[model samples]
Target: MKVRELREHAKELDFTPQEQVRWLAPRQLARTAVKAVLAAVFAGYSDKREVQEVLDADLLEAPCGQPDAREIWIDYVADVGDGFDATSSVAWTLAEEELLVPRAIEGTDASPAVGDLRLRRGSLLVLGGDEVYPAASATAYEDRMKGPYRAALPKAADPPLMVALPGNHDWYDGLTAFLRMFTQQRPIGGWQTRQTRSYFCVRLPERWWLVGLDSQLGSYFDDPQLRYFEKHLSANLEPGDGVIVCSAEPTWLESVETNADAFNALHWFDRNMIRTRAVPGSKRRVPTHASVRLWLTGDHHHYARYAERLPGDPPGTGVPAPDSRRRQMVTSGMGGAYLAATHRLPAVLPLPPPGSRLREKDPPVAFARMGRTYPDAEESRRLARGIAVPWSGRWLPWRNLGFAKLAAGLHAGLFLLLCFLFALAEGVLRPVDAVRRAGLDDFWGFGAVCLGVAAALFVLGFLGRLLRRILRRLRRRRGAAPPSGPEVATARTALPPSGPAVATLSQALVALAALAITVAIPFPPSWDGWLVLLLCLALAAFLGAFVGSGVFALWVLSAKGGQVAEWQMSGQSIEDHKGFLRLRIAPGGDLTLYPLVLKTICRDWELRDEPSGGKRPVPTGKPAVRLIEDPVVISRGA
Candidate 1:
């Protein structure tokens, strides 16, 4: 099933008005709140069981042998498993069928379809991170991961090797389901690459090695996993080999000030594994001439690529040098999870410098653009035709102007309603004489208070802007002297651009307008007026709190959900296509990445070689075949 077909399938699902309301309304928010509370209570127990089981198990160490061919292809996708939604599950299943399945039969050079790159049947398939979602429970794995992939790939006598690494989600259950699915020797649909431990190294053709690390729940590598890498290095590494390091999260992209702990393990790994250097004063060094050419990660739920050049290299170094001191960091986490926004990412990011001063972060401009939605020919054409006006009106000044006006009106109306209720509450609680003196009868007193509130908030906003300006000016004065250290550079980059004063003024105006509406409604001196006022006030507060909580919960799910939805609602939305990286390794150890978008599998399939009549084979194994309920044995050390 292609993306369009899957979209149609999604529409065909039993999504009644109520079901649609569940996802589009606050019902899902209530569900999330309930889940959050349950998770808080039950989450920690899973970790203890997972740790004990891993420590007790006699772990199998199965590093794959190098492929015979001079050139090898590898396809990777991470952060997969669409959470508990039937529609999303079906959509992701189609994505897997399109992307994971080989274009042509084995041992054949099939004619390529437009925009289609054929992958070899026996090519290695790597699940970079986060195999299941909403916590890595056994049921989640079966419903989201195992069942979908089994249907997509099916069991073959000879199938592609599959290896996976654990993301934070996988570690939520203490790696129980992750261990069972990947580490066990059993094949799921006949595509099994044996893994004894969570972390493993695979030797690709052409002196290339793929090392996947387990940055467990705390973003720290466990002692055993570190030891495993140490042993692997001692046994297999040689001088001048090219290495591709795979981690669950991109520590470099994280804010160093807030997430210092997360960076430590990645930094240590980089210095020792890639740079071939010892920790400060440790005097331990690996005997490898290999350099880390690429670092791949996928926890971000979007695609981004950053190329880091050696600090002293001159500008405009365009040519590709075989021995170039360049390392590429790519994040292709858009497997099947809720898509994250990349539109707001800064163009330049700070990364740790190479060698002994690895702790210091330096800003480097990324080569390729970073974003969730890349502009394609089709999207450009649609945008060029221009956005459709709402309500069938023509010649609007701007495409989104109508939406902005609607939103502003809604906000203003809501505020007006709240103020009226508050006034009514006061009238009901206090004596009519007491409230009457406060100008409940005349509009002036009420208007004055409303204006006063707006004025105070506006001044606060203005003062904030003024303070930021002062700080920037002081920093600039200090910056006259050459930046002497990393701290200065970091401080300069961290400061955000000053916001416009007009926005603050507009906000204040909106608040005043809302409050002003209350003055227009006449307040009677009777008990009936007091009762009506009180009811309105109570109802307003109750409804506001209920709705606010739901919106907040959705925001919590994905920080940019509200923004993404706003764009979609306004008809200015980008296409909802998720992508992954396809790395082609040349014999000379040169790596070329194809940023492959997942929409249709047959988009690249050749028309001439289209298969004839037979129905696609479906494996007869039970959908929940690998359900394991073994008791976790706790040892003294564990």
Candidate 2:
């Protein structure tokens, strides 16, 4: 396509259902957004004096003075670190606003990101996991995620309540980071601070009652979430009332047997057939009504829809076995992640086809119990809600070509590999055209052997690294000997107590390696040059695998503080924020602090005191911030 055509196409992908932006004056709104973002990005809101000063300083006063939206986005992009919810709130705002429109045009020659559009109009913006793609850190959130969402927000909005569900990605640094921002849902019991980031019902200006659930809360004893399910399932059984259930992982992708174990039931075979309303002393409080329609989910890296009849509530005998009915399950993880392929319809079953024909279910009960009718709207942790299924259910289906889908990251995967290999030839294996060079042939042989050895070492190194890491963590939990390494006592100076120093080192290594490979390739292609180029590329990859493994190690060690579990009024509505077993620990003897400050900047922990400067006892009130379950492992170095 022509360049203009390409730009036009790019604009098309950023498209959202256009509606008049309310609140802000049109032109003034754009200017305000740009300036506010720029101020928020580089400087923060802590110093209201400066924030307001910056906010008020008219960019138009100076020549080319007003900050452009793209510049604002770029500036906001710089401040993320291991700050959790604060960064999340910002990213959420950016994503919902569809603010990234200008950058989509400026940056590239490809289709815009789909999630770039704001939360659907009149639809409650439900976060179905890893609302923030990486750890809820400032660095990860702002740098890795903020840019893209900002680049996409011109067509979106924060849209009031974004019912967020936690995914492993949200908890990549641990559940606390995920919890810090989303106070409406608390981590369920036994699941640790791994709370049910789920909620029930939202009243948007639109008539629809938007009900949300945190699929991850399914891991507790006495599943209050389940009871809430029965309660709400019974109370809110309105006709055509839609439940836009958000989960990092989708229900249909779940395994029946595994789900049965999580919910402590026989099996949950129906796709999206969540067992909601249960009755007094019943077998299980499975919802019988089918009118609760529409399910939306994420985790997979594509936008897909399944318009078909789902299996009925497994435990409920009241409903006639659904012979066939209309239902749909969708995957909208396409917002941006590792993009994957749209699976072709005639997909062959990886598992054996069921041997026996399926049995039909009985009809649903006519009436649900009273409390059972309403979902527990409280942000309670007793609900055993979770997005727990094996890794296969959560991620197996999607491909991992970052934003490449918008820019050939998907289809171009192999071709990029070929280009990389070709670069190797240009650097290390050239002069084959002058085929008769005998000595060069012998040199080529030596290089190949070395390359092979490097490749093998790379694989072995990664494996050993992974095994050792696993063992080290296992030991930590067992309270055994520490991992074999000189503790970087000075890590505090180099690595903040919030995120990974080791992972940073690894990334630096890979970036340095890619740069080295590029440098190694002596442009016009000579035999020795090609040989060196090839060797460098191989070495880069070999080394990169190890560096990446180091990142994974830090990832495994990550933990953060949780969101407030319970809230109460301080008489005339000046509510005071309270407890959440909030703790921070540094594994390298220095500490990484992923602070759980409520609804603010995703930042490093600033000092905040525990309720009584005392040790943790069973908190009388729900903890607004909980302890980090894992630390973002870092390597302190000289």
Candidate 3:
């Protein structure tokens, strides 16, 4: 298609229902912060699981298929519902009847080679988590997620079943919209939703199972959910059965600073529920031979697998151990969200964590990274550089105009405030004289109000600290380790400052210096003070808009703080290097995973007439689809 034709076609297509989330936008930032705080505060009080239980909404059916129905195909995607380009690309790919294999499947010692594999659409579609971006709302879900997917495949004669796990974003609205959309027995495009709650279990063929857990913003699992799982899982699981567990976040990979609660919950579930077959009131709990064969998640927005290391095998090698019941922990969150960096993933992961309560009694177990990252670490590093100069090519201030304006406004406000402080410092007003000149009959009242505001702020800070202390004490009582998320390691603490702490300190120092330089130079109002003020304001705005992103880039480059990197990259709205998983269960209960990736998304779309005489988007360019790695095979042990 010609450029003009493409532009016209795009305009007429209405291809995108919602634009990608501008994470750095001031309003979006504030809204997200408020939502986060409110969600955390009221998650327990407004527990949706309790409501579901009260309503008897538990639709826990036997895992998806029959015991003998061993062979099946399942598609897994996570962290979806962001930009139209990326989300649509994934939806389009999943909607296709079949995909042509690009390369031969070279055999490995662990997995046999099945060359010339033709990838077909799965009967079951599993959305790992974060199905929508920014926050969860009915409109947001319809626009960002359902719209693109519906356009991709409006209908199917034998539609695939769809299920989803709720991520942090999905829980922003307490799963109100999520449950309504997914559990209403409605259809999203050609995919059908049958899950009655946020969490679900699918029984695949040959005693294999797929369990999607709703961690509820990485907080504690409710009693109802635990009971539901026990009723279905513990009662039915047999010896030597293989299970696949899916969660919204890759808690195994997250550091204590990022998701300690999630990590603890996952390990606890794995141990008590899966391993020991223990429940709240089990009389005699015996360690079950049934094992969790694979652990899957999607909050990280990338493809990374931490495969259990064989007894004597070297790390990063593709060799599989004989009779190995070792599990593979994979993160395939690249459904449609902004890409996360894989360069920072550690080579080795010690399960249950080194010093956690879970590890205190168990033997050490480790997982070595299996293959290179989907985009590769080097490619991720290169992509990360884009954050440094996010506005290099574009019209005017580019798509970051909102962020720029926010920065500029904040800078101007700060400059004005600093000027007032400077004036006060220079004795521009004696307190008594100022009060008299202002001619306020309610001066004392105004003072009281100001003092009250200050006191309120002080109380809030104190309460926050007190809450943390109480939580820590509660954890100790429960024989759990203290969470490290809000705790800062300093010289005063017994533990030394870690890499993230160092990076945070450096970032803070840089920010302070920038603030000092912006205000210090324009000090002491003189005859030419207005010019100085204008220059300072202009500089401050420029810094907020342009240089603020540079600081973010610095954090990304350092690759130390996961949260910091996430904040910076969320603004990138990346369109390429998107992917999903195509999993197949063979007749013999062997599971094969194909990590399919599209390096470049199809952008030039044409409005084409379909078989039914309706119009839909047909990409002028075919998506560049390729395999992230050779198919990963986990065999059903004897």
Highest lDDT, which number? 3
Residues 254-355, candidate 1: write the lDDT tens digits: 533224344567767765665564443578665455667777888866566655544454554242222235566778776666444454443444444222
Q: Top model by TM-score, which number?
A: 3
Cα deviation at 594, candidate 2, in Å, is: 38
My TM-score estimates for the predictions, one after another, are: 0.61, 0.34, 0.77
Regions of candidate 1 where Cα sits further than 4 Å from its true position: 1-70, 83-116, 255-262, 277-286, 310-313, 316-325, 353-357, 360-444, 454-575, 586-588, 599-638
Candidate 3: list runs displaced more than 4 Å.
1-16, 54-68, 104-115, 255-262, 278-282, 314-324, 390-399, 414-544, 547-559, 608-615
* Residue 303 C-alpha lDDT in model 1: 63
In the order shown, what is each candidate's alpha-carbon RMSD?
A: 11.4, 24.1, 8.7
Each prediction's Cα lDDT score? Answer: 0.49, 0.30, 0.70
Ranking by lDDT: 3, 1, 2
Q: 1 or 3: which has the higher TM-score?
A: 3
lDDT (0-100) at residue 203 of candidate 1? 72
Clash pairs (backbone) in predicted model 1: 239-289, 240-289, 240-290
